[model samples]
Target: MKVGTKEAAELLRICTQRVRQLLKEGRIKGAEKGDRFWEIPLFDGKPEVKEGRRGPKPNWKKRVSKAISRICVNQHLIRSNSKHGTNKPVIRVESRGIIRYFHSLEINGSCKVVYRPDKPLSCGAKLWLEVASDVMLTAFVYS
Candidate 1:
C-alpha cells in the first residue's frame, strides 16, 4: 500500500521533513511526489542514514602574516627568526599578571624594575599576539 509522507515519517520514527528529504535524495524507493505531498511505499521500511562526516570541516592550515618575535621574559631579551631587521619594533611581552605596552610611557621607581621608553615605538605595521593564561595569577613572568 502507498502512504503519505506523514504516515511514512511516523512509521520510520523520523520527522516529516527528514522523510521528504529522503524522498528527494531518492533514498526511499518507490516514493513519488504529488502536487504538494509525497507518496511513499509502505514496504520500503526504514532507510539507514549514510555514515559519514557530521559537522563542519576543521581549519588545519595556518597562514602567518606577521613576523613573530620570541621574548624570553626571564632573560629580558627578544629574539626573532626573520632576517628583515635585527631591531624590529615587534616585541613579545609575557607577564604573569598583566602586560601593558605604551609608545612613550616610562615608569621609574625604587622598586625592583624600571622601564625606560623609547621614541618611534612602532611603525605603521600592526601587531598580533596569541596568549594563554591561567586563573589566579601571582605576578610572575615565565620564559
Candidate 2:
C-alpha cells in the first residue's frame, strides 16, 4: 500500500505542512507524483516512520584507563597546611579514579577530614586526597 502526502500526514498524526517539510529534509522516503501530489511507499504493508541519527557512543575503556593512571600516579596526595586551623592541614588532588572530574573526599577516623575540589574535573580527571584520621580509613568516591 502507498499513501499520498495528505494521507501520510493524517496517518502519521502530523500536519500537511510538516509532511512537506519531512520530504524536503529527506527524512521520510517519498517521491513527488505531480506538482501537488506525493507517493509514500508502504513497508510490511504499512507506512513506516523514519529513524533519527544517534550520537557517538562513549569510550568507557579510555575513561577507566585514565582513572587507573591517576590513582597509580598518586595524583590525589597534594595538600597544604590550613592557615585558620594551626593543627589541621588542607589537602587537595587533581580529579580522577572512581571520582572523575570533580568529587568530594570524606575520610573517617583520626582527622575526620572533608575535602571538596576547587574545580570540577573532566569525565576522566584526577582527584584530590584528604585524610581525617590516623586509624582505620574509609574513602568515598563519586562520579
Candidate 3:
C-alpha cells in the first residue's frame, strides 16, 4: 500500500520536509507523485540519507591583495609572532619601564637563577622588549 509523506515521516522518524527532500533527490525508492502529493510505498525500509561530509564548515581563508613585501623598521618587536603583529602604536606615558632586548640564546642563559630578563641586550635590528623599570633595576643583572 502507498502512504502520504506525513505518515512516511512518522513511520521513518523524520519530518515531512525530509521525506519530500528524499523523494525529490530520488533517495527514497518506490515513491511517486500522486494527484496532490507524493505517494511513498508502505512497509519499505527507512529512507537512507546520502553519504557526505557532516560537520561545521571550515573558517574562511585570508586572501592578500598585494605581494608580501617586508617593511623595515629601526627596532623589532621581541614577540613579533604574537597575534596582534609587531609595534602597534600605543600612548602610555609617565610609566616607569625598561626597554631592553634579548641577547645570545646561550646554554647557561636558560640555567635559571629565578629572575630572568636581567641580561644585557644588543642594539640595532634585534628584538626590543619592555619591562617595568623598578623591577628591572632591582632584578639580578647577569653578566
Off by over 4 Å in 3: 44-143
- For candidate 3, lDDT tens digit of each residue in 1-143? 56778856755656889778778877666788978888777532333334425554322112212211111123334345255565442211112122322222222111212222464233232223232211111122233
By TM-score rank, best first, the candidates go 3, 2, 1
Q: Model 2 segments beyond 4 Å from truth?
A: 30-32, 53-143
Q: List the residue pairs that clash in candidate 3.
A: none
Error of 3 at 141 (Å): 99
How much is 16 displaced in model 3, in angstroms? Answer: 0.7
- Model 1 lDDT per residue over 89-133, tens place: 334343433344322222221112223244221421232333222
Error at 19, model 2, angstroms: 0.8
In candidate 2, residue 23 scores what lDDT?
Answer: 79
Q: Against the hidden reference, what TM-scores do the models get?
A: 0.31, 0.32, 0.32
Query: Can you list the residue pairs that collide in candidate 1?
Result: none
